[model samples]
Target: MDTSKATGNNAPRNLTKGEATRRRILDAARKVFSENPYHAASVRMVGKAGGFDHPIIHYYFPKKAGLFECVMEEHVVEFRTFMEHWFDGLDAYTTDKGLAVFIERIIAFHIANKDLFRTLMQNTAHVENFDQFPASAQYEVFHDSFLKTFRKKVHHNASDEEVSKFVYSFTVLAANYLGASSTYARFLGMEGECDAYWDWVKETIHYLFLPRMEKIIFDSESK
Candidate 1:
């Protein structure tokens, strides 16, 4: 809270002091959490990175868990926007086009916000982020869209329990990969190239994963 601590354009307090301070803290936290994962992130460090004193961090987030919740809340909003914009007409989708778009959108979201997703995965510990994430409008958007679309598609072929398990498996696979991606970067050999990541995910989604999963889910009884 000390005016003396902030430097440069972050000088002291700006007009929207509260919002600016919150943004700065979140930005700093994103950087730290991205590099260190959830466990290593510290309030004091995020505060200092934001050009503020330690007390300010506590004043905003109260606890490390609370800060983590904020970060997830922000990202869930961004992700929900992407989903709603892309996953429209879920009821109309009977072909692979919808599923393909859904998968691509999710993968793109993961790539674009790898830092935030990394933090979330480390903290979530193989849980559905929606399960552990605090209740928010953003959560509602994602939860509803995903559940509705999934339930619709798998309705005739599988029981509700089966569908639920399937969804959990799917989410866990993606979340776990995102969590452990740093360790696999060399095999991925992306070297921080977004293109490489996309290429890998694109192939994984379409040729490798989609057809096989579709048959297992939609064609099991026919065979």
Candidate 2:
């Protein structure tokens, strides 16, 4: 084997000790936080999960809140990137067609980041100073990006605030439906029936919001 050749351009770069440790801690903390709510999660739990001591964890993250914020910041960037990719590729010429595709993309996005979705949904109400997190700022960026993509698809002109409200309503519904799937399944008795559950979601939107959405997409007189 040519060991020296292995270190050429195709070779993987190595992380510094501090970077490696921080990565490990972040990975462990993400899992721990995903499985438990924020109030229930602790720095010690993250440290133990990553096979590090209190000092090591503290050296990287001085506070549990800060550590959680870091995890959100990292994961939300990935989320926004996923959204941008889909938004950029949108080719639908009509609002309804574009929305149909966007709905499917939203479902896939939540499924791909189920862990982060669960963590964020579970911890949102419990955390203090929630608006100060980096994820909040990143969220605004993606929110505008979503609106910009959606705007071109609308049949009629709608104010940004109006479009924002309409989009936010559906997004929250999708988030809760998937983020708390277990509860919905158990309570609704749709266990092991993922397709049916999703169909119900679509049906709900179609029946309840379709009229309002139509008005927004087609009614030019609406102000």
TM-score of each: 0.68, 0.74
| After superposition, candidate 2 runs with Cα above 4 Å error | 1-13, 88-95, 127-156, 218-223
Give the worst 10-residue stretch by lDDT in candidate 2: 1-10
Q: Write the per-residue lDDT of candidate 2 for residues 21-77, one digit (tens) a residue.
A: 888998899888887887788888988888878678988888887888788786666
Note the clash tally of each candidate: 0, 0
Clashes of 2: 0
Quick one: best TM-score, which candidate? 2
For candidate 1, the clash count comes to 0
The most accurate candidate by lDDT is 2
Q: In angstroms, how far off is 22's CA in candidate 1?
A: 1.7
What C-alpha lDDT, on a 0 to 100 scale, does residue 132 get in candidate 2? 68
